[model samples]
Structures are given as C-alpha cells and as structure tokens.
Target: MQRSKLVSQILEKKNYLCVGLDTDTEKLPAHLKNKPDGIFEFNKRIIDATLEHCVSYKINTAFYESMGTKGWEIMQETFNYIPDSHFKIADAKRGDIGNTSHQYAIAFYETLKADAVTVAPYMGEDSIKPFLSYKDKWAIVLGLTSNAGSKDFQQLILSDTGKPLYETVLETVAKWGNIDNTMFVTGATKADFFEDIRSVVPEHFLLVPGVGAQGGSLSEVSKKGANKDIGLLINASRAIIYASGGEDFDLAASEAAKEICNEMKGYIV
Candidate 1:
C-alpha cells in the first residue's frame, strides 16, 4: 500500500476509519463460537460488512496468537480475505534486537502479507529500522498510546530535553524513516497530545486506537490529528465488530461501521 494510494482511498471514501479485527473468540456470537472455523467466519463477515465504510482493517494478532497454530492460520486467512484496495495492518506490537526484529518483520510483512505492523520502540532505532526496510510497508511505532499505563513513562518530562519522553520519541524516531514508510501510534485516548504530536511529525500517518470502545472523542482527534492527507487511521474494534451477539451480528457490525464512517465524513474537511 503506497502512501499515495492510502490517501487516495481515504479521500475517496471520505473517512479514515480503520476497522480493527480484535476478534476475541470468547466474545464471539454464541452461534458461531461452537463452529470449527468460527473466528475466521466472524472476521470474514465483519470485513464483508464493513468493506465499504473503511479504508483499512487492523488485525490485532494477540487475539489470534493466543489460539496458537490454529490462530496463526486464522490470522493469515483473515489477512488473505481483506481486499488489497484497503490497507491491512497486523497489530502485533513486536520489537526486538536487529536480527530478531528482522524475523518479526518477516513474520508480519512477508508471511502474513500485511501492509503495516504495529511495533514497540523501547529498543530504539535498531528495533524499528527493520520494519521500515520494505518499500511500501509501514512500521507504526508507539508514540503516546491510549493505555493508562502510558502515563508512567511516555509523559515523563526529560531532564535534558525539557519535553515529555513521547515528544523526544517523536523527534528522534521521525528521523529514522521517511513519512512514506513510517507512522506513529498515538492513542485516541491521548487526544490532548495530538497537537504537540503533529508539531513534530505533521506529515506522517497516525494509527489511532481507543476511539470507540475506549471512549476517545473522534471529533477532537480529527480536528487535532489530521494532516494535509487526512492522515489518521481511526480504529474501532469491539464497538463495531461485536455490535450484536446474534444472527444479525453482521448487519449490526455494518451499521456500526457505517455510523462511524458517516461521522468521519463530516470531519474530513
């Protein structure tokens, strides 16, 4: 997925919504839970229902990885099911030393064929550089995450820089890769910091989680986080995918996604 193609899709769709397939097997519709391929079935339905409303789909690997080999197969199948017209992301949050990170990159970018993979940056440039080596693939580094625990470290003001650690992260990490292959994960819950985030990397795309189920205000993020290309992949997982727990789950998911997409249309300008 080229940066230009992603922006073109966003503009054409009038929404930057990135539906997250954070499909929890325990939370699947009662009817589908007992089936052999229930997880993939759920994902297939969700992808089919919401295809028109979003420009991307983020498949959170944790949910699948927990299922072991079967889960990995399902994850790969789900990735294959997604249309190439939309950006596909593997939310693995993986990072390690150089050689290890290369393997992680291969797992997500090569094996799973995802357009992007979410990565942790605690290990510094070596941990993140491998993911950026692929031409059009992206490494979505954690900037200021939506999780509450993010406060413990990301917000700490550095003695040398006189700026929050996340700010320093944004400044330094932005230099490691160009906008085409680099993006930052700034949680929608951390909406307050979006303005400051943009000040450092205005042109890079942002993978924004915590929007729907996490209670982050979409409007606030849109107003503060959007770039010239509307560079925000606003992800709504449980809110949309698990909208209903019955036979009508697909329809419910479609409506849920459509509603968010509609709200997004208003913020596009």
Candidate 2:
C-alpha cells in the first residue's frame, strides 16, 4: 500500500492500531487444539473480530515457521485472508549480505505479498537496499527498539555525532529512502526519545511496539512521537489475542481492540 492510502486508513478509521498475530499453537484455546487447522481458525476469528478497530496486521513469522511446512502454508493463508484495505506486515527482522537479502526480499514481498517487512539495519544500506527496490512495499528498519538489549548499542552515545547510535540511524536512513517506502521501528518503551527522532525524520512512519503486554504508555507515545500525519502504528498482541482462553476468546479480543481504538480516537485528531 502507498503512504497516502495508509494515511487515509488511519484518518478514516480514527485509528492507527496494528494488531500483532503472534499466534502460538501451544497457547491456543483448548477447543482449537484438536481442530484440523486450529492456527488458521484462531487467526481468522481474531482478524474478523478486530478488523474494524485496526489498520494493520503484523504476523511474527517465527510462530508459524516453527511448525515447518504446515506452518508456512498457514502463514500464507493468513496473509491472503487479510482484507486488501488493511496493511499487511511480516514482522521478520531479517537482514543479511546483499545477495541473501535480495532473496529474502523476494520471499516476503513477491511470494508472500506482505506490504511491509521488519528488517534489521545492522548490515547497513546494502542489506536494506533490495527491499526498497520494490514499488509500494516498505522496509521497516530497526531503530530505537524496546528490548533491554537495545541499551547495548542503540543507546550508546557516539562521540563524533554527540547523539545516540539510534538517532544517527534515523538521520542517515532518511537520506536513503523517502517516507513513501521507508519506515523506522521506534519502540514505545523509547517514547522519551521520540522528540529527538522526530527532528531527524519528521515525515517517516514508525512501527511502534511495546504497548499493552510490554507496559509501554499509549498517551506518551502519541504526545511525543506522532507527526502531523500521526506517523505511528502502535501494536498490541498478547493482550488482545489472548484476552481470554475460552470460547469467548474472540469477543474478549474484540473488546480489547475496541478499547485501544477508542483510546486512539482522541490522539488521531
């Protein structure tokens, strides 16, 4: 999807929620465990339940890939199942040498047909360039991530630039790709850094995780990170998908999503 259509969806729905489908077969409801296609069944219900409240769906590929061929098949099925109106993301933090990254790009963008894929920028521009070559697709580069390990590198102050490494990544990458086909992953846990980040790439979209289950603040993210276009796709996974483990799981999930969407309504405007 183009940036215009993505921004349009956010405005039209009064939401910028991205529901993460990190569905684990082991954690599925008791009734679904014995079903023939339980993974897809669970995802279908969650998607149906929350579609009205979200603009994007992020599938963490590891959960599906662990199940082997069956998992891969269902992953594609789930991707194909999402409505064209919603942005589809493969939350696969993949980055490698130039040739390998090209194949990885083809796998997610061409074969699986995801609108965006999360990529680590550790390998620098060569690792990310192939993904950006595709039209209307996005390379969501890892920037200021939320995990504890981020402190090791991303937060370290650079002597030359007099800024943290993550800020340099954002500023340097802005020159590599425009807002239309490039975005950065700015974790909600790093909400305090949003002001500095905005000064670097004011127009780029940010795929923010760490809310809900991760205890990141929604209000803070909005106050500090949101651009004039509301350039943030805040994600909620376990808190919504696993809202309840009973037959009413879908209803609970819907309620969780609606609650977040309602909260987002105030921020979008």
Candidate 3:
C-alpha cells in the first residue's frame, strides 16, 4: 500500500488497529476444532467480524507453518479473503542471505499478496533489500521489540556511537529505503522509546505489535509515536479474536475490536 493510502485510511478510520490472526490450533473453539478447515473457518469469521474496526490484518506465519502444507493454504486463503481496502501483513520475521531473502520476499509479496512483511535486520541491509524491491510493498525491519529478550541485544550500548544498538539501527536502516518503501517494527510495549525513535526516523511508518494481550499502552504509544501522518499500526491478537470461546465468539470479537477502535479515536487527532 502507498504511504498516502495508508495515512488516508488512518485518517478516515480514526484508528490504527491491526488485527493479528495468530490463530493457534489449541485456541480454536471446540465446535471448529475437529473440522477439516477449522482454522480457516475461524479466521474467516474473525475477519468478517472485525473488518470494519481495523485497517490491517497480520497473519503470523508461525501458527500456519507449524501445521505444514495445509497451513500454507490457509494462510494464503486468509490473505486473499481480506479486502484490498485494508493493509495485509505477513508477520513472518524472515531475513537471511540476499538470494534466500529474495525468495522469501516472493513467497509473501507475490504468492501470498501481502502489503508488507516483517523482517529481521540483525543481518544487515542485504538481508532486507530484497523485500523493498517490490513496488508499494514494505520491509518492516525490527528496531526495538517488545519481548523480554529484546534487552539481550537491541538495548545494548554501542561503543562508538554512545547509543543503544537499536538507536544505531534506526539511524542506519532509515537510509537504505525511503519512507515510501520502508517501515520499522517497534513493539508497542516499548512505548517510552517512541519519542527518540521518531527523532531517528520521523517520516517512516511503524508496525507496532504487543498491545492489548501484551499489555502495551496504546495512549502512550500514540502520543509519542505518531507523526504528521500518524505512522503507527497497533496490533492486537488474542485480546480481540479470542474475546470469547463459544458460539458468541464472533460478536464478542466484534465488540472487543469496537472498544479498541473507540479508544483509538481519542488518541489520533
């Protein structure tokens, strides 16, 4: 999606929520658990329920990949099911040697038809460049993640720059691709760092996960992370989709999303 289009959606919707379809077999409602297409059916209902309340959907590849061949089909089907009006993200977190990365890019952007794919930048620019080669596609490189493990490397101080490693990453990675083709994945749990992150890459978009179930503060993230375009995509997975486990699951999910969307209205403008 073009940056203008994404920004327009945010402005029009007055929210930046990105519903994550991290659909797990263990979490499937009892009625759908034994069905052949249980996972996809659950996903369809979730999408149908929450489509009006979000601007994007993130399909975490791990859940589907764990299911083997059948999972890939479901992932593709889910991607195809999302309306073109909303941005589609493949939260795969893939990066490697240039050629291998190129194939991964093709797998998501061309085959699966995703608007963006999350990537690991620890390997350097070559690992990310392949994803940027596609028009209107995004390489959402990891900056400062939300997990407890992020402190292991991302927060380490650099000897020469007198800055955290992720700060250097934000400075350096921002140069590889212009704002149009690049974005950063800064976990919403790391809300305190948003002001500084904005200082490094003020014009680029940010794919912010770790809200809701992960307990990240949406108000703080929105207050500091938003640029003139409101460059943020706040993701919520289990908190919304699994809002209920019974037959009312779809309505419950819709209500959960509506609550978040309403909360977001107070932050955007």
Report the lDDT tens digits of candidate 3 across residue range 1-269. Answer: 99899999999999899999999999999999999999999999999999999999999999999999999999999999999999999999999999999999999999999999999998998998999999999999999998999999999999998899999988888888889988999998999899899999998899999988888998899899988899899999999999999878889999999999999999876
Q: List candidate 2 stretches off by more than 4 Å.
A: none
**Per-candidate TM vs. native?**
0.99, 0.98, 0.99
Query: How well does model 2 score by local distance difference test?
Result: 0.94
Candidate 3 TM-score versus the reference: 0.99
Question: Tens digit of lDDT per residue, candidate 2, span 89-175?
Answer: 999999999999999999999999999999998889898999899999999999999888999999999999889999989888778
Question: Candidate 3, which ten residues in sequence have the lowest lDDT sum?
Answer: 169-178
- What is the Å distance of residue 221 in model 2 from its true position? 0.4
- Among residues 3 or more apart in sequence or in different chains, the pairs in candidate 1 whose N, CA or C atoms overlap within 3 Å are none
